[model samples]
Target: GGSASSGQVSRGGGGSCAFGGMGGGGRGVYAPTHVRSPLSPQQVTAEIKRAQSVVEVLRVHKRFRSAFNYIHLSATWNVLGRLAARAPAWLQQHAASAGALREDTHRLLCELDAQGLSNVAHGMAKARVTSRDMWAASW
Candidate 1:
C-alpha cells in the first residue's frame, strides 16, 4: 500500500487495501488515461461513411494490404457496433443498410484471409457478427 495507514491490520484484523501502492500517496504510479466522449449520430454516420469511402478507394487501387493497415477495418466494425448500441431510434432507422455493411465486412475479411492474415480475418469476422447481433438485440 502507498499510504502508511493502509495495509495495516487494526485491532479486529481489519485493514484497507490500496491498489498498486496507490495509498502510499507519494508519487504513486502514474498512467495515462483516455477519455472518449460519446459520438453524436451525425459523427457516427460520418465515420461509417468515411470507412466506406476508404474501402472503395482500396478496391479501386487494389491495395488490400494498405486497406487492412491504414483503415483498421476491424476497428471500424467495432465503432459501428458501438454506434448501433448507442444511436437513437430515429438514427438507427435511417442508418445505412446492415446487410451491405455485413457484406463489406465479409469482403474485407476475405481480402485479409487471402493475404494469409487468417487469424486477424477470423477475429474481425466474429466481431462483425457479434456486433451486428448486439445491435439487433438492442433494438
Candidate 2:
C-alpha cells in the first residue's frame, strides 16, 4: 500500500489526484499527510478563508470539494476565483487542482447559485481550463 513518504501527498481510496500519483494504489483510503482528523465543512471553509497562498488553498481543496454542500458551494467558488486571481502562476503550476474544481463544479452545477456560476467561469478562465466539456456543462 502506498503512503505519504518524504512529504508527498497521498490520495484517498476510490479517488485520483495528480498531486503525487498516489491514488488507489494504496491498500485503503489514504488520509492526506496533513490531516489528522476529518475536517468539518465550517473548518474547511475557514481554512480556505485563512489561506494566504495558492498551495494552502489547494492542499485542502480536495477535502472541501468532497465535504461542501449546497450552502457552502457558492462561497467555495468565490474563494477559488479570488485565489485564481491572486496567484495565476500558481494556478497554472497546479493545474490539476483546477481540473478537480472543474469536475466537481460540473457534478455540482445544479447546486450553485448565480454568483457561484460566475466565479467558476472566472476561475476556470484564470486557470485556462477551457475544455469543450466545460463549455457544454455551462450551457
Candidate 3:
C-alpha cells in the first residue's frame, strides 16, 4: 500500500508507488485507486454522514453497520453540518470519559475534516472526518 490516487489527489501509505524500477528497468505497478473512481461530492457527503451516524449510534445503541445507518438516517438530514459541526465539543467533553465511543467520535471528525467539502475540491472533499479526540479519549 503505497499511495491511493483518484488522480486528482493521492495520499501515500507505505511502499514505493511503482511496482518496477523508477530507474526505468521494469514495468510499473499501477495503484488500485488509480483505476477506481474517486468518491463523488454526493458520495462524500453520504459517507461523512454515515460515519457520524455510526459514532452516535455506537455511543448509545452499541450496534454495528446496519444499526448505525438506521440511527444515522433517523438522526438528521444535513449530514455533514450535523456531523462535523457537532463533533468538536462532544469530542472534547465526552471523548475523555467514553472510551471506544469517544474514539469513534474522534475518528469521525478527523475523516470529515480531511475529506469534508465546502465547494472546494469541486465539493468532492465533503466526506467523513477522523478527529484527534481518539488520542485524548484513549488516554
lDDT scores in order: 0.34, 0.53, 0.31
Compared with the true structure, what per-residue lDDT tens digits does model 3 show for residues 8-127?
121133322221221111112221222222544344335544565425533432333222221122232234235444453443455433354333332222112223212222211122
If ranked by TM-score, best first, what sequence of candidates would result? Answer: 2, 1, 3
Instruction: Give the poorly placed runs of model 2, Cα more than 4 Å off.
Output: 1-37, 122-139
Q: Give each model a TM-score.
A: 0.28, 0.53, 0.25
- lDDT (10s digit) by residue, model 1, range 34-127: 1332554344334444643333423322322222221244445444444333333422343344444434444333222122233334533443
- Superposed by TM-score, candidate 3 places the C-alpha of residue 48 at a distance from the truth, in angstroms, of 7.4
Best by lDDT: 2
- Across 1-139, the per-residue lDDT of candidate 2 in tens digits comes to 2332342323334354333223332322233343343776577668777766667767767666655443344455556656666666664577687567656554444433445556666765664445543344544
lDDT of 1: 0.34
- Between candidates 1 and 3, the lDDT winner: 1
**How far does residue 103 in candidate 1 sit from its true spot (Å)?**
1.4
Q: Which of the two, 1 or 2, has more lDDT?
A: 2
Ranked by TM-score, the better of candidates 2 and 3 is 2
